[model samples]
Target: MRVLVAEDEQDLADLVATGLRRHAMAVDVVYDGTAASERLAVHDYDVLVLDRDLPGVHGDQICQDLVGVGARTRILMLTAAASVPERVAGLGLGADDYLPKPFDYSELVARVQALGRRSQAPVPPTLRRHGIVMDTQRLQVTRDGRFLRLSLKEYAVLEVLMRADGAVVSAERLLESAWDEHTDPFTTVVRVIISRLRAKLGDPPCVHTVPGAGYVL
Candidate 1:
């Protein structure tokens, strides 16, 4: 999933971005609401982790604006306010979920994943094709019953290709969805990741390259 994290606390935002990246999500962080608005206008994110009290524009306005624009991105308000009124206010502003600050990281992840699911068009929990199986909820992938050990990037690239269901997925699209904003668009990073992913998936050579076009599985 691609996510936008709008939090003024740089350290906390960085930490959350790192944790989400470890789980193979494409994350972008902005320190203030204006930057958040800029990124939101540019990228089609699946989820937005917003801090209610933001400097430039205030997270409440961001949430309300997102709703006004009819964006499919699910909003999860993350703030230090734990009062009932605060939670109600956040939700009333169009947040899909709310989590008080000092929250458990695992719970945050679960909530983000849930919101991500809600944002996307529904697909099966486990995706299977050509003897390969991907259990998204369990983060497990197996081919003909043999488990595959894949790094986070490898797993992410494979997931994107497999989800394509044999349709061509361009390298640009892959980069946009699997990597963060820091990735160089001109780099061969997507090629390298796909090469490694294929090697790990092994034998059958399901993944294929279509020169001048894209890749298919």
Candidate 2:
């Protein structure tokens, strides 16, 4: 999933971004609300982990703007204020969920994952195709019951393809879904990752290229 974390606390933002990346999410971090707004305008994020007390542009205004446009991105508002009224107010501003500061990292991850599922088409926690089984909840993958150890990027790319359900997925689409904004648009990383995935998946290849079209599984 792709996420935007808007937090004024630079340290906390970095930590959250790193943690989310470990979960195979493409995350972009912004320490101020202005940058957050810019990224939000440019990227098609699945979830927005927004801080209420952001600088440059208050998070409340950001939430209001997104709501005004009926954006599809799910928002999880964060704040140091833990009162019931505070949460209610945050949710009232159109956030899909509210999470207080200093919250459990696991809970944050779970909430993000839940919101991501809501943002996209309904997909089961587990996906299976062509003898390949992917358990997203456990972050596990296996081919014909044989466990496959893959890098996070490899797993993320594969997840996009598996979710396609045998339909063609263009390389640009794959890059957009699996990579953050920092990735070079001209990079061959997608092709490299696909080659690596094929090698790891082994025999009776599942991922196939469609000449100029893209790739299919």
Best by TM-score: 2
Q: TM-score for model 2?
A: 0.98
Relative to the true structure, candidate 1 reaches a TM of 0.95
Relative to the true structure, how large is the alpha-carbon lDDT of every model? 0.91, 0.94
Model 1 score (lDDT): 0.91
Give TM per candidate.
0.95, 0.98
Candidate 1 lDDT over 128-192, as tens digits, reads 98899998877889999999998888888888887888889999889877888989999999889
Best by lDDT: 2
Per-residue lDDT of 24 in model 2: 99
Query: Which pairs clash in model 1?
Result: none
- Which stretches of candidate 2 lie above 4 Å from their native place? none
Q: Candidate 2, residues 1-217: lDDT per residue as tens digits?
A: 8999999899999999999999999999999999999998988899999999999999999999999998999999978988999999999999999999789999999999999999988989999999999999989999999999999999999999999998999999988889999999899999999999999999899999999988999
Model 1 misses residue 170 by how many Å? 1.5
